[model samples]
Target: MNITVFCSAYSLDDRYSVPAAEFARLLGSGGHTLVWGGSNAGLMGLLADEVKAAGGRLVGVLVELLAHKGYQGADELVMTADLAARKAELLARADAVVVLAGGLGTLDEVTEVVELRKHGLHDKPIVLLDTEGFYAGLRTQLERMEAEGFLPRPLAELVSFAGTPAEVFELLAAAS
Candidate 1:
């Protein structure tokens, strides 16, 4: 299945490089497509590199603006004219989304999916790969949404949390 993973160009330890690369390899080996930001720096770079090394298809969606800001481009990428076009392409191509540990950038992505489902734009599954309690706070916020009237309990059920790379990928496989 074509699975898009939303992540950032950096990792906190900044040690997220290896894990991102490893996750890409694992997904590739499991016959899943690797989709991410088109950059060859930090986690973004490692993810694409790992996918290429594993002989898996790596598709990158990047805005012409941030293409070089991150240092490089994806192994298999098609440049977009602007951020809007890039995002549209990324969302259109993926069957499912797996959000790994990321900073504000990743948070924006996950929230976009939530908003999409909330507005009835789409009903795609969103899997949060919360390694090391990365998404604990976001999870809490979502739970609060369900508690209040801001988000319906049924709509809030759209997102799933997976604590490990193995668990997240397994969920992806099951979606097929």
Candidate 2:
């Protein structure tokens, strides 16, 4: 599977980095490819390094601005004119999406994907890796949206929650 991972580009928290690397190892050893932001920093770098070391393919979609930062670890790098185009390319090739602990950028990516799914644009499964309960607040917000009838469908129908990397692989396998 080609799994697109949305995660932080600069978070020093081991609570997030450790699990993200483990998940990458799992994905790599399982013969899955990683599709993500092409940054060799923070969780993005950790995951990319693990995947490469484990012999899994890495595909990176980067905007022109960020690509200039250097140290991008992707077998194939796809450069886009802007962030929107970068995201579109990322989603276009992904079989599934796994959102790890991240900040505003990650939130933006996940929300856009969810909106696409809600509008029936795609049926790809989106998994939230709630490492250390990091996504608790977001989960609550999603629930509130569902309760308020703002969501087109139940939250469960749109996203899957996995607390561990093993569970993430299982969800991805099941999604495929």
Candidate 3:
């Protein structure tokens, strides 16, 4: 599987980093590839490192503006003209999407993918690794959207939540 991961470009606390690393290890040892933002800055870099250490392939989709921060050892790197194009390419290359605890950029990536799935543009399975209940509020808001008919499809069908790295893979496997 070419698992596209959305995560922070800034350094994060162990509370977030530890689980993210575990997830990376799992992805690699499972003989999967990582498709992600091509940044060697923080959490993203850590994920690439762990995944590579565990023998996974890395494919990075990067925006031209952040080219200076690109990962040096990705198995393949793709450059996009802008953020929108970068997001598109990331989704284009992924078999599935996994979101880890991150900031605005990560949130934006996940939202666009879910919106696309809801619209039937794609049928990829989207999973959020809700480490430490990091996504509780987002889950609540999405449930409300489903309850209020704001979404065209059931929220659960568009996305699923997993509490651990193992659960993320299990959900992905089940979805496939």
Comparison by lDDT, 2 against 3, better one? 3
CA lDDT for candidate 3: 0.96
Q: Please report, in order, the local distance difference test score of every candidate based on alpha carbons.
A: 0.74, 0.89, 0.96
C-alpha RMSD in Å of predicted model 1 compared with the true structure: 2.2
**lDDT of model number 2:** 0.89
RMSD of each: 2.2, 1.1, 0.5
Overall local distance difference test of candidate 1: 0.74
Top model by TM-score, which number? 3
Alpha-carbon deviation at 172 in model 3, angstroms: 0.1
Cα-based lDDT at residue 111, candidate 3: 94
Residue-level lDDT of model 1, residues 1-176, one tens digit each, is: 77788887774454455556667888878776777777776677777777767777778887788766442434467789976677668778888888877777777777887788777787667888777777888888878877787785463357888877788777766765
How would you encode candidate 3's per-residue C-alpha lDDT over 1-176 as one tens digit per residue? 99999999999899999999999999999999999999999999999999999999999999999999999999999999999999999999999999999999999999999999999999999999999999999999999999998999999899999999999999999999
Query: What's the lDDT for residue 131 in model 3?
Result: 98
Q: Name the runs in model 2 displaced over 4 angstroms.
A: 70-73
By lDDT, highest first, what's the ranking? 3, 2, 1
TM-score-best of 2 and 3: 3
What residue pairs are clashing in model 1?
A: none
Poorest lDDT segment (10 consecutive residues) of candidate 1:
67-76
